[model samples]
Target: MKKLNFTSITKYTILFLIALLLTVTAIVFLEGRKSKNISLWITPASYFNEGWYYFDSDSRRQEIDSLPVRIPADKFGTARIYHKMVRSSHYCMYIDYYAHHQAVKAFFNDELIFEYAPPSNPGWLKSYRSFHNLIAIPLNRDGILCIETKASISSTAGEFGQIRIGSRDELLNRIVSERLPQFLLGAVLIVLGFILFIITAFYLRVAFDRTILYFTLLLIFLGVWQTEESRLLQFFIGFQALHWFFEYMMQPFILILSFLFIKELFINKKHPALIILFACITLSIFTQLILQITGIAQMTSTLFMINSMFIVVFAYILVLINLNFEFARKSVKVIFSISIALCIVSFIISSAVKHHKNFTDPILYLGIVFLFISISIFVIQKTQKQFNAVRSAEIYKKLAFLDISTGVSNQTAWYTLIENFSADGIKLDKYCMFMFDMNNLKTINDQYGHLEGDKAIRSFCECLKRAVGKSGDIYRIGGDEFICLCKNIDYTRATQIENMFDYYVKNQTESKVQFTAAHGYAFFSPSSKADFIQAQSMADKAMYENKILSKKGRS
Candidate 1:
């Protein structure tokens, strides 16, 4: 109702937290009532014993959530397990283990289904003793799938293990867990971002802090890319090609966000590194696209490795910039660190799952939450900093032009305005100027003290300011003298303004501090080399004539 009121960091933080809480609640509510026809089961490390039958545990373990097993260096041995499948259509089994070679044999209710060896390189921390297995076992009826693992007899000084299992819809769930929530979160951010854009567009006309507005928009685009990649939405919506396209396409958004975020946060205007980074991102995307289309394994491998390394390197660069800029406060830094950590964790989980089967990780959504909060903190801090800087500048500017006592333009500011007019040259062909000297200010000060005389001067200035409207500038050039310059105006407007001031002063019945003002007008050509002093002299003479007339009237 109050248009978000994001003037303070606290208000913006509160809004972000509320939005996050609402999103989580909605996701949970949406997931709670689902009735999808898919087999759901958990496969822990010790699911079978003695290679004969499968068993269910009475208790659940924390490590069983996504099947991250730790195998010690000494206990290197083989394990045989028999798993009975109740009913199978199109089924997938995912196994994540910390081993090199875990040979698997599958059996279906006394009949052998298949026997195969898990890939030697499951792509889990390459050269480390970690492997993941995804086996798809299709069948027409309910049967038993036995898994007998034979450890490498020649293994020396390292852990050898592999996770083995088989199920229906495990692949879909794994893929969904990796990409769905992230995609949806991205869509939400994009929509909300445009809404913020609309608000910013409206405020920019009157707003002094343009930096905050620009950085906020950059963060919104970052949110979009994080969502698209994390949710694998490209794959779901656009097929395999879409997935491949997104893998490269998402790179540009990341590069752009990093460059813009760092630039805005640090106030760096001419950093060539940012341009280079964008070009690199563009090149990488093109290379990746070509590699995916042509299916060049060598090129693909080289590019993937390079991209992954760049991610780590660029993230480190961001950290360096964050440290150097000091743009983020302590609270903001903590939030950013946590979010970055979660993002790294999400990437690790996604990469690990791509090699394994059955086990699914829920880190994508968690990472989304962290990234959003981090970006929110950065954005809020940046906005507040910029707003404070601009407001301080405005305050200084106001002080520069204003007379402290009279609350009107001072001599210094009057000269500054004249200089500006000098730069532009005179455009108007006709104008009015008025110069006034308060009558007997020295006598008034001696009789009634300086304070009373000062009050009279301030009152006159206030009246002149009110009567001047938008056509004139009022300047207190001296203690007793003031000048009012009105451009693109004639004697008629000046007379009207003078008459209004005189009427207001006459109607005041409380005070007897009588005041009088004199004014002058001229119609000089733009080509004439008339300085402000010449105009002031003409106005001063005209004022003297008016004053003599007033004195004669009083006599």
Candidate 2:
């Protein structure tokens, strides 16, 4: 029967217990805070979507059956949307909507109430993509609500989104809840990126792979871009410029970093196609920034071009992967290819939805998340492979230098240690060399068996190890002989170790085989190979003399 390793079992048991305790605690905390009344927590808002009238720039009025009245893309001018307000007594009534690439003014009963991005501003200043608006309705009054909108961009003229009316707090809560997942996911990715960056930097000496750094950067940029896309930050910081800058700036770098990350998985580091793509994307980013800064063009105006570049690069990467399929790692070939393909499909879908509905879609973000997961899998696989290789190398190294029977350093290790010291010209200052010879090993083997002799040898080694402790290294140089080398030890310490060895050998009771050994030690300060050999010879001679004396006493 095999003996059980109680120490390992106990260690695992403790870890499992700790994990269970933490899980239970978390469950209890979550259950305690869980809300029972879901309806009360989430108040449904009413949509003021139907029965609206729209008047175009040509003074032509049209009765719209529903909200989100879309004007012609070729038309670039002011438009008016009219709807009758219904006062609600049960809630603090407010109307909330989104304005996209347009300036908006709200009037209640011919009185100006709320306005954003007045027509007096320059075209550049009014070029913000989207902003949310909330207007409170006066109590005890019923009047017609008119929203006047102006769009300088022809593509976005007269685009009105869904208008919702409800309690102010409920509407705000609903909006936040809708965007919270994307915001949290982005924040989590950013935090995870920072954590990975710190870990890679801390273990930079041991970790040779640069892919982790690239992947971390990619995560951070993806996070920033996703958060910006969520529009949750707009609620906290009203400045649209900051959000626009990050959203556009992070997109280009995300592409570059993703390319670099994929590039690292391949055997060939420098692929011409990838380099060209990288340079082109970088140039486009710089050009966009310069144009936007100079007021020659807005970043929003060039968004379609950037998105087109993304599609081109994504498709090109698929082709590139096909061309270099044989060069990439197996993990990369399967995971990266599928992830990129899925991302491309999702990007197309998301673009279509955004173009159709004039609103942000979550499909692209989901695809990005999937891509991140795949990249993480690839990195983990690579790291695991490297770890296994290093572990195998270390195991092989230990086997080469270890004695099978005695579990001590073998003769080869001793020779190697001496050669290393000699080659490095290291002086053995105040070093003690102890030699040990087992007694009655041949008698035991001849009378009982070699198995008993092996047991005796192991027993002798165990006692020697106990005596030596951490002060010296023990080596099994021969079948019945051993050597212990101690650094920075004097004659007095050598005598103490010798006494300890005898005491341990006499008191050893684990093995049924009777075991004894004769040992002798010599001090030396050798600076050369010859000097080390002379010192070893002296210790051996002293061990032989002690062996003979021990035999005579037994006689």
The alpha-carbon lDDT assigned to residue 120 of candidate 1 equals 46
Model 1, span 1-555: residue lDDT tens: 555454776877989999999999999879977966455533322332223332224232222222233222224444434444556454544443223444545555766555655344323311111123345554556766555555533232222233434342444455455456667777777776676666545653226344445445655765555554564453446343343334444455555555555555444556576556556666766665465445443232434543453455346544744666465457657667767767766655645564343343355456546555655666566556655776788889999988999888899998787566632455545656777766677887888888888887877777777778788888999997888877777667878888876776556433357666555444443343356767777878877887788779879
* Model 2 C-alpha lDDT per residue in residues 259-282, reported as the tens digit of each score: 676677567567677677777777
Off by over 4 Å in 1: 1-183, 192-220, 223-247, 263-314, 325-329, 355-362, 422-430, 487-490, 507-512, 523-533
lDDT of each: 0.57, 0.77
Task: For model 1, state the Cα shift of residue 85 in Å.
Answer: 23
Candidate RMSDs in order: 13.4, 7.8
Per lDDT, the best of the predicted structures is 2
Question: What C-alpha lDDT does candidate 2 achieve relative to the native structure?
Answer: 0.77
- The positional error of residue 248 in candidate 2, measured at the CA in angstroms, is 1.9
